[model samples]
Target: MSEVTDLVEMLEKTGIPMSNELIEALLRTEPSDFTDFPLESFWHDFPVPFLVTDSGVTKTISAPHMIVTMLHHLELDEGLHVLLMGSKGGYLATLIDIICGHGGKVTIIEPHDEIAEHTSNVLERRKQCGLIRVLGKEALEDPAWDRDVDRVLFTGSIREIPDFVELLIEEGGFILGPFGGRIQQRLMKKEWQGGAWLETDLGGVVFGPMDIRESERGFPDPLFIADEFEDALILISSVLGENSEEVYRLERLVESLRELPPGLPEITSSFTEEEIIEHPVIELLMTEAEWLNELWPTFVDILGFDLEGIVPDLEEPLFGKRHADFTP
Candidate 1:
């Protein structure tokens, strides 16, 4: 059996809800280049896909559900031409193949020549070929990819949304990928409306790497503040419309405060837990804000020039320290 079929069988045995035989039937016939067992680093915790890298081989985790979620959100169907950049082990591409079937076309652009060759050979040997294609090229210079696709997917992160992506879409096509860095990403779709693009940010997510520009080294701080306050505000606004209950609470909070504060510390201190719980939108704001606050600190600690911000002994909260609060 091909490595792809073997993997599907393994996932099925692990209760991942997939059928190896069914998947094999759907796939195009291709030969297996991988005869020896793939090697995974000892540090890996999950079944990360692997590729034959020049520097011995590297493995990384991939979220199958995450891709499915993006596809469903885009309302993707057959007939859509998709461009996938940064092929990760061809596992994700296999899933997409099932979804797109033979009617839809998927072209994968990979920079790693060895990885490209392995994936290309496997697909060609499997008899489930033709509907899928592969190319070994740098994403930064691919002029043909500019605005020529119905949906563009970047498995890796991008420092900035490429102009080529805008050219690929046909005024209404959607593109999804990591916007900032590989550390964290928010799945976003841009719709061409009027004369400009309208952005819809889904939420914070963790993902595998992408075809990043050589100049792109670290995460680019987004224009909006990365603190708890901004997180809450953005989430509440996105969920409830202008006249919703959440919006009213935000307005009330703004009105009560004399001036805008710099960080979440000020906002949290200003209002009591009771006040926050009573507000319609403050609940969601609080949740997202707290999450962002927890995330930003870690990102900073890891990426900051001076490692002084690092929390050395970080541990999960001991929430139930005083289990029984009533006096005996």
Candidate 2:
């Protein structure tokens, strides 16, 4: 296969969306001439498109810019501790090693024994062990590692952000990862604050699932909140009023939320407290008798939509109860 074909084949597995610009950028690289460093071999040719390309001797094009762009929203500085969950080929982890700079620390967690060993060897050759620590074990149960990590970047898809990660970040610390499944893949950033989390959907992208298998049984399946659904609810609720069939759709929509699959691209939620407050949909929904009641209003409020009304007595006949009587 041609180099471009080979690179594309490698990147295909990552499941990240690629534009023509990204593809063209990667096609220009001379993978054969990449450094003898093993990890360098795993770097995909820039899959970015519409960029100039030339053939020449081996020259290094740093991906820190790309990596930083991927992680642009995150705040980093000296003394910050970072956890790189599911460090796979170590491409992203290596970039973090560079950006963390001196005195900063990065811990790479990988479960696949072979890849873990290979990554360990590669880091050892690069003499990056001082700044980067490779863990060939489970990240979830590691009690010795600092829980107060400044950031956690899961290069793979996560069905949910692990509670361990929640404990790791200081108040106001940020976490970035891909969540959902095949069609719902997206990048999400979350910030911890006083007793709550402020989450923003950065946009959509592809990624792979973490290799580690969960030992716990009966965990909920992953379900994604779609941007389209959120927008649809707002549009229908606003223009159609709370009594319209759209209200039923919105209620069913919220009820249908399932645990999202790992590696799904990020998507916006209809119930976003932020969007509803800024949009006109909440007001229209608030005018209705069914929606104006407490249970629904509280749900809207917790999601960040503000409307004045008496709280409803929310109950699911089949399930017997609901969790957020006072969410909003």
Candidate 1 global CA lDDT score: 0.51
Q: Residue by residue across 91-206, what tens digits does model 2's lDDT show?
A: 45554555565777888877655556656775665544238888864655768756577888876666677776777788878788877643346788887888688899988865
Candidate 2 local Cα displacement, residue 275, angstroms: 50
* True-vs-predicted CA distance for residue 75, candidate 2, Å: 2.7
TM-score of 1: 0.52
Tens digit per residue, CA lDDT, model 1, 1-328 = 3544554455455553334423443244221232233333211224344564777756443543454355455555656677787766565565566666667777788777888887787667554422778886555466545555777787766656676556667767777776765455677776666668788887777664464443232211112223222334444455455676545654554443424333323223355646544343333333444233333343333333221221122254311122121112
**TM of each candidate vs. truth:** 0.52, 0.49
Residue 234, model 1, lDDT: 45
Off by over 4 Å in 1: 1-47, 138-146, 215-328
Q: Give the root-mean-square deviation of each candidate in angstroms.
A: 12.5, 16.1
Cα error of candidate 2 at position 219, Å: 13
